[model samples]
Target chain A: MRGEAPRGAPNRLDLHDLSLFAGWDPGGRWRLFGEFELGEALVVREGRLRTDQREFDYERLYAEYDLRPDLKLRLGKFLTPVGRWNLIHADPLVWTTRRPLTTELPFAAHASGLSLLGEGAWHGGVFDYQLFVDDSLALDPDRGDRPLAGGAGMGLHDSFDHALGGRLHLLSADARDGLGASLAWFRRRGEAADRLLLGGDWHRRRGRLVLDSEAFYRFGRSADDWGGFLQAVARIHGGLHLVGRYEYIRSADLGAEGGAGLLGLTWRFHRAGVVKLGFQESAGPRVQPDGWILSYGLLY
Target chain B: MARGAYRSQVGLWSWPILAVLLMGISGGALAAAPGIAVVVHDPALAAGLDRASLARIYRRWQRIDTAGRPLVPVNLPADAPLRRAFTQALFRQSPEDMRGFWDERYFQGVSPPTVLASPEAVERFVRRTPGALGYLPDCRTPPDLVVALRLRWPRAAGIDPFGLCQEGD
Candidate 1:
């Protein structure tokens, strides 16, 4: 569960975030994966907690059939396979208490679409790719989609009339070191405007140290904006990790600018469970909220 | 008042204890290795494999072998000591680290290799299944199994394979 309030406000502790995930890949030809999330704050007024802000979200519902080890086709609503963060943005997988702001713009995290994901291996490592297409089916947030994905400027599925996106990711076959680049485009759903996004991400892990970063450039009808985050996690002892992240964003549409430097410590009880506390220092031309946040995330 | 003091002490000590336990579990303290032999069914693919070959094959990175046959890498259960040694020596990952590896791989629509219940099962499966490969403790190599590579362990004779197979042994 997670929640945030300013340093000295009528700080109220309310139920914040919870999720359930189930996946099966029984060493067979078929696989099933899904995620159910309940988020409270993002849907309501920034400071005021309301029941209307409470939302149930279906982040993913997909089934895949394997053509080979390297190739598979997926059907249903899946996380956009764009940058590294969005796909692994579930609470349990992230290192910081608050999400980096760059993940919020351009498109919703959920895309009801189809994807062709495959990989090629060489002496160096494995190179993987994903191709995806989603239609302009303006989904209602109250109807189990992203309730707060519209905070940036548009609804979760309102980006374009239709969309086409793909990613090329390469990592050590062992998954220790990697990098990726993605490109996407879609015309405005009901306007002459259009939006295209170009993104790049990279990560490397050696022994007790891990480093990762992702950046995106937006080409929109009104303004060209950009943002990214660089983060590091160092294992201090056992399951304990010390984490640091620097986030920067320039949102031309929302007029929100600037960045934050965050330092955190986490105790991972499992690969999918962690307790994290972090402090953020806001800076730059424009300012984002600054506060200390505590979060506990679990996956069962 | 006494009970409150004890409760506070428990709370203070619990996390450090858990941390120590996790470190012990993640770090394999077995006899480094237990003399594991890389075994395969196909005669043509029975050559001694290098560290990269083991990494590529077990990771399912390069699926086809030298003979142009599709390769299937089999494993004894996740708790097998040989697996711990292999991961540490070859893949340079602790068992805890491998868990993170698989979780990340699932994000890419990839699954870890198949795990059999026993080393005997792995040996039999590799023997009968074409292009199948596995490893076993050196003491029990069945005649049908072709030794692709032999890996040595420190004090190999003193460490029991079953001891390595036991969880956190």
Candidate 2:
């Protein structure tokens, strides 16, 4: 369920979505994965059901082959690894219902391409890297989806055929701490500005506390935008956590600056089930409504 | 003569009883401080492996072995005490604490270590499957299986987690 209430507006609630994930490794070296979601599966506003909101969305569909035990070749459409959150953005895996705009806004969040991915040990740490190229010929394009702040914003709707990107992450020996960097270049369908994006992310876990942050800067003839968010989660006890975040984005297209502060609690009652309740307040420009939000996500 | 014969008979009877008591005491001491042994099929593959490397292999982060072959790590049942001890000693984490990590890896098309029904099953699998790795109660570790790292967990913390122990011999 999702709830949003604009200033002086009545609060609205709706059944948010249902997602399906399938992964298959049928012996040998070939593998397949897919994730599909039924968005706005049901909606109720002013105590009445709305049927027009339901639609099917394909989030990821890809095929991978083992080039070696340490390397892989992936082909098809998959989540763009801009930072960290985009790769694991499923509601059940994240702590908050409101995604930080920095993660999604500056670039497209998903792309179709072939990628070379691998990881290895380095100086007692582990590093994984990926290099990918996406062309105009996409496997299955969701034109309705647009590039926004990793998760917030109303920015680009034009599709890009020539896109190239790479990401690298280094994790501590314990795998509890990591730092990541991402770079991408692309051209919009009708625009001449060649878009270039540079982003970085950090994650650290100390005892029961975790800290995550990501920032991005985008520059091109068509876009000049920068944004980021800092989030922290403290484990209150078993399966219960207190989450807090501050996010800000400056979109040249909107000609306005937007920022939001959120405080919430997440209860992971089961290993694959999570419930989040948060209250958010916005200052400057409004990217999203300021109100109470609740969502429940499950992975079956 | 009769007294001497009787004494000889009592002495003979007491020797076996004393031997049995001694054996019981030693066995009890061994049982009191059992450790977990990280085992592999080949001794060469056992080198350079410590608690951290074991943790990485089990986490699926280090997928390949020294020879560039995929490593197959196995685990006992989740509820097994040895499994708990192994994870705690190596990862400083509980199986419950790894749920989020596994969930993310699941989406990445990575799988958790294969779980066997028991330590005996783990031992069998490790011995039969090349590049297989597993852990067992030190006392249960077979001599033919190469012991890579010995972890004396919470129950046996008095002993060193990395030091050689007799059970793995």
Candidate 3:
């Protein structure tokens, strides 16, 4: 459940979602995994229930085949492996309630197609890669979450008609520190411009302190966009963290350019549950409006 | 001018104090416990395993061994003293600190190792199941069970192949 209250807006609460996941390993090289979500099940405005906002979302449905101990093949709908955050963006898994604009605002969050993933030890570090392609219409895409840019239909925050991309990361032996890069090329619906996205991310953990950052730029004809954020989480005590982030984003098409600063507290009360309280201040064009946000997430 | 000098002096002293505090919290308890032994099924395989491999197996970073057989690693309950010692020695992390890692793995369809109720139960399970691996206090490992790596007290010194310990620790 999540509750939000902007400085001047009414306090609102909603039952955010219930996610069901299933995985089967048939004792062979083949495996199956699927995720289904019932989202916005209930919404309350000031004090009344809002029925118009309820929705059911199909998040992911995929099958995997183990080509070898170090390599695997996956097919169907899955989260795009652009950066580390998006792969583990579940509310319980991430540090903040607000998603970084750089991770999701520039591209679709999910892709339906095929992917190849592999990992191996190199020197004293580990190397990992994921390459994927999406060439057709997405399956059951939730277009409502995507917002408009300029006056074009399905312009910003929309799925690609065709996309090809890959991400590569090199990490310390313990997987506690790493740096990665991503590159992708795609075309938008009803537009003739070709877009190329370049991204880089890095994270390091030492004792009770962790620092993470990412930057991305999408090159398109008359619609260039770029953004970046650096975040830090320092452990104050058991399960309690002091979180801070600074971010800036610019979109030529929407004529929006701004930055935001956030300070928050995250408490992992249990292994599969987390409660977050964040207060944000933004200048313009924010993904999540500037406000106080309190969210509780649990995995059953 | 005097106040600025005093503030700079305090800032200089804070780092060493904080460093010592962090060290004491992360490693002090493990220094009091006995050594931990990483064990597997085949005795010969013990000679080939290294500290890096053990850390990888437990973290679910490497699911299969060099022979392409799936590795099944087990653990004692989270609160077990021996489990804390092992986690601190291998990953330099507390059980509480690892919850986020396991949660991310859970989201990716990979689960943490199966946890047994006690060290005895872990020993019994590892003895019978092929490709099984587990950790226990050094003295509890019988001759039949193979010791892959012995993480002794004073973890900074690194892996102790001989499994040596003092009378009490």
Candidate 4:
């Protein structure tokens, strides 16, 4: 018999952050699991004080079953497994901080609903395909005053109304040696829209050289927008990594392209933990002063 | 004058004596190489694997067999010197680090490779199951079993050369 845990019990917690996670998996042919998260953080936006914000969130609660070797069924609230960076949790990430603007602008981390996942490998290539139906709720505190809308904006209320989307991933043969290319697509319901993302990464172990580049084309009913980002990281021995990234976003509604460049270094004391220091400067159309960022992450 | 002559003669004699003693020790150690075997149930598989491939299989990177069955890899006790040698040759990471890697994987719903306690246990399990692969000391190899890869510990050279398969003694 498979082991089981109680529903809604605290399975993990971090005192420094005052965060708690509770989850349970019931033993059955169809496995069921659920998780909850509660935490607090301080934010300063537009030089205004947004301090000590309390957040009560349902991280994930889902049931999954394997119908076949290549097909699986999932239902309930879960993280949208779209981008490579989004599928894995932040704590286990290679970088101390996440790719800002891009990941945040679309949606919050998880959606509640049903999904179908298919994964397989053949001829030295790997593929992951997913189809999902979700009722999403955005969690951005700053957007509280904005009126909700059914499509494209956070105005959609607790109406059983749903969204439909999917993603497809095709990886090249040389992924193990750290050189590969991938293409991904996502489309949400209620808006006549879609997004196509293409990305490639190359890495060499001898000198610790890495290059990552990605392009996104957003197609909507009114007008289309395009954006691209590139990042390079080099290990300078003694557990220090230097990184640089450039990003640009252009839309039909906007007069000119807006973008930012980041220069950073990360120190890794352990495989699952790191400390990072970086400077970000925004330019073109809407410019912001170069600011410094310090962050740390731990994974268990 | 006689004392000086004796001291010089003794110094010359000591150099040749030390060289001859060191050569004898190395030669004797080479003459008696310990017999360590790499054992598996399938003859074809035993012939197909090289050192690098075997290492990859143990590391969970190569999950499928030539015939497409999910390969099940097993190893001896954690502290066994042979196991250490095998992992050192295969993973280039310490066993403790490998354990940590697997623990994280477990949280992600992935299972690590199965571990067995002894060579005899590995041999018995491999003999009874298909898709099972393991290693054992050469002298205990069963006739029905095949020799997939062989490793020898070189006391003289201070390194263990792995995946060297040869016919008979």
List residue ranges in candidate 3 displaced over 4 A. A7-10, A136-158, A188-192, B1-37, B42-53, B65-68, B137-140, B146-169
**For this target, which candidate reaches the highest lDDT against the unseen true structure?**
3
Worst 10 residues of 1 chain B by lDDT: B153-162
Task: Report per-candidate DockQ.
Answer: 0.07, 0.24, 0.22, 0.06
Q: List candidate 2 stretches off by more than 4 Å.
A: A8-10, A136-138, A141-155, A158-160, A188-192, B1-36, B41-56, B61-71, B88-92, B129-131, B146-169
Any residue pairs clashing in model 2, and if so which?
A103-A150, A104-A148, A104-A149, A104-A150, A105-A148, A105-A149, A105-A150, A136-A161
TM-score of each predicted structure versus truth? 0.72, 0.81, 0.80, 0.58
> What interface RMSD does each of the candidate structures achieve?
5.6, 3.4, 2.7, 8.0
Give the Cα-based TM-score of candidate 1 against the true structure: 0.72
Better of 1 and 4 by lDDT: 1
Q: Write the per-residue lDDT of candidate 1 for residues A85-107, one digit (tens) a residue.
A: 88877667778877776765655
Candidate 1 yields a Cα-based lDDT of 0.71
Candidate 1 vs candidate 2: the TM-score winner is 2
**What are the per-candidate TM-scores when only chain A is compared?**
0.84, 0.91, 0.92, 0.68
Q: What is the docking quality class of candidate 3?
A: incorrect
Segments of candidate 4 deviating more than 4 angstroms: A1-35, A41-52, A89-92, A135-161, A171-174, A177-207, A251-256, A284-290, B1-169
Better of 2 and 4 by TM-score: 2
Better of 1 and 2 by lDDT: 2
Candidate 2: docking tier = acceptable
The weakest ten consecutive residues by lDDT in model 3 chain A span A145-154
**DockQ rank, highest first?**
2, 3, 1, 4
Enumerate residue pairs that collide in model 3. none
